[model samples]
Target: MGASKVIHAIYTDDDVLMSAVKKIKAEKHHIEEVFTPFPVHGLDKAMGLAPTRLAITAFIYGTIGLIVSIVMMNFIMIEDWPQDIGGKPSFSFIENMPAFVPIMFELTIFFAAHLMVITFYLRSRIWPFKDAENPDPRTTDDHFLMEIPIYNNNQLELENLLKETGAVEINIVEKDEAH
Candidate 1:
């Protein structure tokens, strides 16, 4: 989409923002996006957005790390190097598993953290050297902003609805294409 007109409203309280979301969706207006300084409970339910899948990704990454560590350690310590530096049996992969656990746990946490961060960045369309598309700076501080895109004909109706929902301030903004 290029240069779509947007109506933005800023709220001071999260409860007021949540109430505005419910009210706007109930009246059948399309909410383009909502920005908040912090996570607001129940906001996703109000917006009808599904729960995030990052937890699933984290679990998969951790499982992969665990399996890889176990396989690598088994092959290296058991088959590759049959050492008896301290009378430790190199063939006992099961018996030596306890010593290998710290590395496995560290690898699991490393993979989970890196993959989860990458997933979140990609999902949010953010990356290195990419400019953030924050609509209002206040949204990063004490304000919650809801951006609702509407047809020109529905502008007045949307404005009226937002006013009724306790929006502290509202504006009709026009977005211009970058290129």
Candidate 2:
């Protein structure tokens, strides 16, 4: 396959970028990615991305944490080492459940938070100490970058469309060619 050409359309305003994305999608053009300094409200919807499932994952992780906390506390405090919980010798896990509430709550939050971060990192292909993959460094500041891949050798048409959509600067960059 021939090396694809990537068009980087730089827009200063997110409103303009969002409109461009809608227009481009209407033309049935596939947008590769969009980079902005901060999150742009409704950009994901504009790009027609599916809703994120991370929240569901977080809830599942929290449930696991709650179960773990209950099991671990039962083993440690009630079964293995029966202790005087709340100045009462509560030998039952249910009876001692009140004292374990705080631990369970904290563990639920901890597991959900930590696991969610790891999930997001993995999903984004981000790892610790990794170089940034942004095509332009300016996108990290005040600029927004929209990357579109050219197919069918329709470069001029794409360029014209981008120019009409209020792109401040448009650059045609070649993807890394493999020999």
User: Whose lDDT is greatest here?
Assistant: 2
lDDT of 2 by residue, 104-172 (tens): 999999999999999999998899898888889999999999988889888899999999999999999
Off by over 4 Å in 1: 1-3, 177-179
As a whole number from 0 to 100, the lDDT of residue 57 in candidate 2 is 98
TM-score of 1: 0.91
lDDT of 1 at 161: 93
lDDT of each: 0.87, 0.92
Top-scoring candidate (TM-score) = 2
State in Å the error of residue 91, model 1. 0.8
Model 1 over residues 44-109: C-alpha lDDT tens digits? 889998898889999999998888888888888888887785887787789887889999999899
Worst 10 residues of 1 by lDDT: 170-179
Could you tell me every candidate's TM-score relative to the true structure? Answer: 0.91, 0.94
Candidate 2 segments whose C-alpha is farther than 4 A from its true place: 1-3, 85-87, 177-179
